[model samples]
Target: MKKIALLALLLFLAAIGLFLAVVWNGYEWHQKLTVTMDTPNGPLSASSVQQMRLSDKRGPWNPPEGSGVSFTLSGEAVVMELAPGRYLFALLTGVPSLGRLLHPKMDVIDAAKLLERGEAEAYRSVTLSRRDYPLLVTFGDMNDPASVQRVDPANLEASFGPGYRLQSMTLALTEEPVNTGRVKKVLAWIGPHPELKLSPPTGRTSNIPFSRRVGEGDFIRGKT
Candidate 1:
């Protein structure tokens, strides 16, 4: 009870702080940053920088888009205002200067299955805007895009960590043939958290050992 009360107070304080920042800071605080994919040889949208993820035709996965664009806060430029929701950085233009996204036709679903039955090792790798804190990622496929399926955070909090919503998901990039096992291994390498709470597509879920599911809503649309 004491812990719960303290947690509630903290949440309330955070909400108030965010509201103040939004009101006082205005768009200036959240003004989007723009950069070019020098190799792209074209123009692009500034929004992708905080929303872009390089993946197959399905979208949103490892390696991230815009290899030439701002990779993260520490990349081409620095990020000033950080938020709690999901963000991606792209090379203004989706197309990487004439270069194309690899494995544009691969299926994230199949890649996930391989990761499940211990047959695949595919994973998504990308940099983050904030370089200070270790970022937490919740792997999502078709079956459980949110990963948690809106069950209870208590079920996942131990593995994915707390205060982290869905930031982004990683998908396979090789189409001709994807070594799911290998991909998972790669994702595990860049992934700050090794113990993944893999929630298979069968509606069942499992925690990697270091995650905790604190509640039901832990599986927010983006966080799950």
Candidate 2:
């Protein structure tokens, strides 16, 4: 009977140790960043943004897979900020709740390096087409217009309209702490959730106001 009790105690201690280890490795602090973009109509800012996530795990386990930040600008676009050390940027159309459609083109942006450099700039051309949906919006790299991917009409979401036009835009990032205190950090670690949570779209409202002009070129400038 004594041996059985000792064995049970050992098992309990082992379980406690494992739980502490998981909590320690899972504990992380994140900062919320706001985004602002310059458009043809005016400067448009993302209504919701996901916090930048960093994990305590090392090696291949670090950051897990497909883990990164995202910014949702209502009916405008969804920007997925991916790649850890070297960031890769992709723009999608749609909202978070309804589901976002990915754009074939992906842009690489070294945010930390750009922060040191003061700013980063890229030129792009915007195109619009008519489909079963209201409007189809497409963006291409002006530097290499020929290389732009030909997206299938079925893959696009009907979001924009005639007045919608994007010429030049600037993206700015400002970071604020999300988990600071010990109690708050522990609570955050225990009940982890997605960095950005937003409601579904209501109707065909124009969130991004763009010019009706076709084949227009735009500048994408970023600042830390």
Candidate 3:
């Protein structure tokens, strides 16, 4: 009886080990990518970054908990050994020049205060898909048509305040893939939530005719 019991225990342990191995194999496919920058500031490190995982079938993955790739940045280079899945990467620096179009009145500093005041600021997002191995990504000053349009001296000065100029930095991947269905889902989600929309203060503006009259019927009614 003792011998039989011991053998049964061993079999149970072996079954568990095999199950774990299969699960790891199914979930652990990863590839390595190298990223660099041309500016003197050097490579981006862990200090200023945000990352998200992507699903080939569903789009971006929002795990209830944390589940993503790991990377290391050295000087102007970054090496990411991410699971063989899609991912989004963002590097943080100073204010993005073209971001002015989104919130003309808000500077990065002012945006930060809005956070402190329990408000929110929206940031611009761009996506690129990479399908090849040994991938390399480069970052430097932005000169793209969209960036150029937003940063034109006249536009920036008008929107971002007098004398303000727009200077932008950007990222580029060597092997960009066409927009995948998954990327569209991710973009749809990056927009500001409805709750974040702030209503303008209730008051008269210069544009309103001084002759206009206020009426109680114009106000929203409450349930009796």
Top candidate (lDDT): 2
Please give, for residues 168-213, the per-residue lDDT of candidate 3 as tens digits: 2233221122222221232232222322211233476666421132
Q: How many backbone clashes does candidate 3 have?
A: 3
Query: What are the RMSD figures for all models against the true structure?
Result: 23.5, 17.1, 21.5
TM-score of each model, in listed order: 0.16, 0.25, 0.21
User: Which window of 10 residues has the lowest lDDT sum in candidate 1?
Assistant: 72-81
Residue-level error in angstroms, candidate 1, position 34: 12
Residue-level error in angstroms, candidate 1, position 93 = 25
Q: Model 2, residue 167: what's the lDDT?
A: 27
Clashing residue pairs found in predicted model 3: 29-84, 43-75, 43-76
lDDT of 1 at 182: 20
Local accuracy by lDDT, each model? 0.26, 0.27, 0.26
**Which portions of model 2 miss their true places by more than 4 Å?**
2-24, 51-53, 57-224
Which is superior by lDDT, 1 or 2?
A: 2
